[model samples]
Target chain A: MSAQDEGRPIQSSTPDGAAAIGRHAIRTEALSKDFTLHLQGGLRIPVLRDVDLAVAPGECVALAGPSGAGKSTLMRCLYGNYGAGSGHVWVRHDGRDVDITNADAREVRAVRRDTLGYVSQFLRVIPRVPTQQIVAEPLMARGVPREDAMAHAAALLSRLNLPATLHGLPPATFSGGEQQRVNLARGFAPGYPVLLLDEPTASLDAANRDVVVALIAEAKRAGTAIIGIFHDTEVRDRVADRLYEVAPLQDAA
Target chain B: MSALLTAEGLHLHFGKVAALDDVALEIHPGEVVAIVGESGSGKTTLLRVLAGMMAPQAGQVLYAGEDVHAMGEAARRRLMRSDWGFVHQNPRDGLRLRVSAGGNVGERLMAAGARHYGDIRAEATEWLKRVEIDPARIDDMPLQFSGGMQQRLQIARTLVTRPKLVFMDEPTGGLDVSVQARLLDLIRALVAELGLAVLIVTHDIAAARLLAHRMLVMRRGQVVEQGLTDRVLDDPQHPYTQLLVSSVLAA
Candidate 1:
């Protein structure tokens, strides 16, 4: 597909689309998304339409939109959690822009392992896995030794205010805030070049929320490009460089 | 990377029931693929067909670009002995219950042409430790071991040959939850440590989530859904898949 695109003249709406494609950390080209309700007689519900989003290295863009305006949908599309209805979702992985929309499973997985990281609102609890191991898994998958990964996980958990005692136990028994901290630690542990955070602070207390803000700031200074959905205005203001509004479509009722 | 094993258009019938219906999949090197479904979903049948224990009436199973069904009986058996392994749900089926733990593991090494008794025993002892079994129990018969130990022993025996691909049919089935967790963790670590490709069929979604990178949701012998494990579990698109995910009791 990229080969075919290279042969055709690059036609993009944004003046910098061609230039940004070469330099940006991550970007979308006329991206669109929708859902089909199989139970509801296959009714199609359109979400995002022609979303041309781009994030440069070291910058943070927070998605701003009303509930049901497709904010989370857009974030999932950028992270390849949701397949795009049309157009390309390009991510710079290993020094090349990979279109996540059409990339093979292995290629997408490779990009996710090294370049893209996402911290959803809730932790997908792995039964019986210790909290520290949960956070350390991404690092281990990326080839970090187990001992080093565990230490990195512990350090991040401590920074997030999760007690050391809880780190040895499964996060299934932890409070919502504690589990969220574990999720945050795991996502941020990899220091991915492009991150999609869906309300990273939604379940956190003020103190831990501040720690997250600090983590995001630290990540940004290290040349990471982050796209996030922050309901907490204070935290959003502290970490986000700008807001990208996802306006609701008018055609669907 | 090319797939270590691939099956296409697999079709089988048990009387009026379609035990396997047009099933197709590929297992790449060092990747874990789980087949998940309720009872009688033909997950075990799929595993058996893929491992060459059972043949589908239609479709082809390929190992390294060679047709599994087309291979000579001796050649296929040799492949199972050296390049592939199978872990039965019951350890008794996979292991020689009368044989000592070390002997059980050593049998595979001997089958692969190891004639030196000391070398075979040494490798078996090492594999025993790798699977978390006490090396001291190397001389103990498998019947004397606990259910979990027997399962671990079965694993050790299969892995002794360093098979590039393994087929596991409900490896953690019928064990206590705690024991199952430990075994699952051991299997996860070993798979990573050795970079072995695994095809696991299980009814346990939790086990699938813990071990498999990709999952195929089977129902009535058909692959109703398939994708990255977390994606299929977290955001199930098919109604059957949604029901399967929602039906799991919270742990």
Candidate 2:
């Protein structure tokens, strides 16, 4: 699972192939991000400042705060969608140590394809592409045969309650809830080491929400590191092993 | 203590069954009291009575020592406009479905005699930000919002006028479990910031524990128990209260 060192303080272990060293699937040391307000005469606004966080294998860390507290911004930074202005976002990917904040495009793409799963708030699939194929792309990229990938895709979609007939159709016209389920299926299909979830069940009904809750539990049990922003407290309480409160920069002491 | 609102000897009947029976309570300014009960326990009926939305068969609801049921229609309407706010279980019930998200909040401001389009729009934007909604979505219709977003918009609509007393009936009901906590946190923060007297009717005891200073337990149209939120939840004297607390914890 992970190597141990006295100074690092080895707390526990996970299943095989979880993390490279320290069992820390994700770690951010003094991470900071800021935005230039061009409309306001180039004024700079601090989004996250001097923030330190860590997520171990087999644990879910929930980001809790009021909206506009930079929760989503931090998630984007962790997934390499946004760069960190300073500090580091160290992630364990496929037995390699990758720094997401300043990683080159090729490195970021490799880590994203091989070890990270992200379910953003909205679905963005190529137009007219079959939903099943889009969901299967992750596994296929990792060298799983097309047939095997499609089979896994079908299973995951079915588990998420997506109808069988709709698998071959594009998800562009699907309802919001349906689109969200499709997004979840694709993110989970890869069985990646880490998962970044943003309001994964935001539009889902109670029944579908329970399915997602179960999925999160399974991922944690499988030793996946999960960093999620759940505006829904119930799901956070059910899945999160710990919470990291992201205070607004103005409120930081 | 000078109670801001009080109810006495409240009794109501709907067809063959009693909706509320001999209910009495008092609310002070800058306090939050939560009413918890199962469906058909007459929690909503009691809230409606205290908010002056309905009159009981025999009882008196007083606001600032004045009789609510005895007020003239215009005066009652004015009282609701100026000093009272109501948050329905469904955001659609409390919000103007056809209006823009900002327009809904603006209407409340207009009712309270705010004019000048620039100032009203600015205030609306401010309130939306306070409720954790993106101010850039101010012009969007409430119909386009998600359930959680719509509920937050409904809150901004009700509180924009700075009402002295607010009545919320299952404010966080109909929302997914994950979205409920964020809304509750916003409501709790706003309630404390404004020091608005709130009487929240909910089935969620956890929400009560988070937001309310006092707790009221209702059963079969009567007050079964009442005390401070922590005390009543920690050591329940009534069997129904004990069951309710345990059920929430079990869930």
Candidate 3:
């Protein structure tokens, strides 16, 4: 289904300018993203076109689509990891609305620290850093006392079922499942107001997957706006309050 | 079905503060019940009382239809060792940090009368794997595991005996979102598969919703609402419950 097929974008007009993103925890208005194929004679391939989405506190919105449908691209665009082609992607950060597409680097970093948390499929480990310290770095950055932060990180690792013997070792040599757990621990450590989960449970087993689902439910109840891409239908059904279809560009055409 | 556990006219006091007042409840076989309330609501006191960890000034806690308090000290200890599991809020409270991870799991098997060392070790390894820990790390001490791992190890130790009933006090408290999430899932699955009765004390309504079949919403040491978990959470009739449900959403 195309964006047009999923009912009109529910954006209300504001007197100050375009629709206010402050009205929701996360909102994107007419977001258009295109990737340039410089290798193929600069082909301007459109990824997300005129996409509008709003996620409210205590709500979960699942993005559903096939591979190569730009769902991940859209998530990156909202996180400012990928620049948009046109339109606004606004996030409520520190009690104010900041357009991710236009926000400066500092503003974007602040939002990442205080307002948003993203959990991807892989862990980005700094070689030689202890697993406990890696998870603690973010909390330390936010001014948590060093001992308290490390304790919290250790607690998080335990929850992920990572054995205690590996606490002092780096995650670089860990298995895929272990690395994924580390990444999840970090993403969930911050308790950001909005969480973006991209198959957070992809490498997890039934036990771990259930944990991720419970975590998402708790976050929603705590008033965190969550946008996640869960390929597993059962997981999506359990956690998502609504579905937002991201039709491929070819389908839109 | 017969009651697996019961409490009658429970009362306790901490100096001038009445921690519990005329509290009463029961649990049936294979039933998962949750006690939820704000801090200082005496939910924890009720859990401790039922677990026979703390003596109540007035009232009786019955396990298998007998007064748990009236039982001989050795009998109570044996009952706790063989048929009951306790998962504390802090993993450290339940785990022996000095013991090797496998030893921690093996201890329970031994309590259940597993005589052979080789068999005890194998069973410990098996339980460790069941809780998603790598069995190869069986010799590692609980002191070395992360907080989440320690909690899982504690769970393994508690459930290794396949106890008929478990008492949990905020089983997922203080852990990160994802970790707590997984633990809740583990608890739910274990409770179902083992057909074990559980009485959990938690302030998290979401935890109650996911794991409990019935819920007791307490205020000032009294249950203001009690019913099927879905009924109470979805359409709470009590004013305090309404405020709690809405406040949790707004937070």
lDDT of each: 0.87, 0.84, 0.82
TM-score of 3: 0.51
- What lDDT tens digits, residue by residue, belong to model 2 across residues B66-132? 9999997899999878999999989999888889999999999999999999999999999999988
Candidate achieving higher DockQ, 1 or 3: 1
Question: TM-scores, in order shown?
Answer: 0.89, 0.50, 0.51
Q: What is model 2's DockQ versus the real complex?
A: 0.01
**Residue A71 of model 2, lDDT score:** 98
**What would the per-residue lDDT of candidate 3 be over residues A31-105, giving only the tens digit for each residue?**
998865434455678889999999999899999999999999888877766656789878887666777765643
lDDT tens per residue, model 3, B56-142: 999999998888988978888998899999999999999888889999989878878999999999899889888889999999999
Ranking of all candidate structures by their lDDT, best first:
1, 2, 3
Clashing pairs for model 3 are A154-B147, A158-B148, A158-B149, A159-B148, A164-B144, A164-B145, A211-B181, A211-B182
lDDT per residue for candidate 1 within B124-206, as digits (tens), equals 99999998899999999999999999999999999989999999999999999989988998888889878899999999998
Q: Indicate which candidate wins on lDDT.
A: 1
Q: Taking the tens digit of each residue's C-alpha lDDT, what string does model 2 give over A1-253? A: 1111101111122235634457789888799988644344556778999889989998999999999999998998888665566887888876656777655433465678888889999886435558998799788768898899999999999989998999999898999999999999999999888999999989999989999999999999999999999988998899999999999888885
- Model 2 DockQ class: incorrect
Q: Distance from true position, residue B247, model 3, in Å?
A: 1.1
Q: What TM-score is obtained for chain B in each of the predicted models?
A: 0.98, 0.97, 0.97
Q: True interface contacts reproduced by each model, as a fraction? A: 0.11, 0.00, 0.00
DockQ scores for all the models shown?
Answer: 0.21, 0.01, 0.01
